[model samples]
Target: MREVRATDLPHIREIYNYYVANSTVTFDEDAMTLAEWRDKFYYLNKQGMPFIVAVSPAGQILGYALVSPWKQKKAFRFTVENSIYLGAASTGKGLGRELLGELIKRSKAAGLKEIIAVIADQGADASIKLHRDFGFDEIGRMGKVGFKFERWLGTILLQKSLK
Candidate 1:
């Protein structure tokens, strides 16, 4: 894994777009342009957030993990919301564990005291378990909070304290 570079956005976007188009991993119903995606990452990087990509030995991006503000208010400054995405072919390979672990390490280094993961109720059992294995506790489950694909999807909120 390594810090995300500007050149890495295309590959990263590709991985994300696959899920956006075909999976319930995210609630995003539409795909974003490369420029918009680049700007999004730029803002996070500018704010000193860590956006990392896991690359194969041949340098292909296999997955990515990032940390962003949990909330806009200053009182929430010491906590962050995390996101991790991998290529469809990359799941179940233990890459998610390594990627999340790295995000936690970087979050702690950034002086973050809390990490929040909001996982979808559908198709995220593995993710919830992954967070649990890494010491995050499920604080709550929001019932039918989001609608996608003609269905209501709930969210599980998990928290991990770096302190």
Candidate 2:
């Protein structure tokens, strides 16, 4: 795993867009464009947040992990929302664990105080377990807050303190 570079955005976009198109892992109903991805990368880069990627020996981007401001308000500056996505072919190989672990380490180094995970209730059991295994506590849940793929969906909120 290594710090993400500008050139990695395309692969990152591809990895995230897969979930947007095929899974409820992300609530985004449409695929994000490369421009949007660039904006996000710059935003996080400007905020001094962590955006990491795991690459294969062949230089393929296997997955990515990042943290963004949890809210726009200045008071929420110390807290951030975490996101991790792996390519479909890269799952079940402990890459998620490595990415998430590195993300937390970098987040703490960035002086972030808290990391929040908003996970979809369905088709995200591995994500929930991943956060729990890292000591993230279940804060709450909201049911039927999202509608996608012809059904109502919900979210599970998990949090971990860097302090």
* Candidate 1: tens digits of C-alpha lDDT, residues 1-163: 8999989999988999888888777989888789987898889987788889999999999999999999999999888999999998899999999999999999888888999999999998899999999999989999998888899999999999998
Model 2 worst lDDT window (10 residues): 1-10
Deviation of model 2 at 5, angstroms: 0.9
Indicate which candidate wins on TM-score: 2
- For model 1, where is the 10-residue window of minimal lDDT? 16-25
What is the per-residue lDDT of model 2 for residues 1-163, given as tens digits with 9 covering 90 to 100?
A: 9999999999999999999999999999999999999999999999999999999999999999999999999999999999999999999999999999999999999999999999999999999999999999999999999999999999999999999
Model 1: how far residue 152 lies from native, Å:
0.6
**TM-score of every candidate:** 0.97, 0.99
In model 2, the runs with Cα more than 4 Å from the true position are none
| Alpha carbon deviation, residue 60, candidate 1 (Å) | 0.2
Q: Give the number of colliding residue pairs in candidate 2.
A: 0
Clashing pairs in 1: none
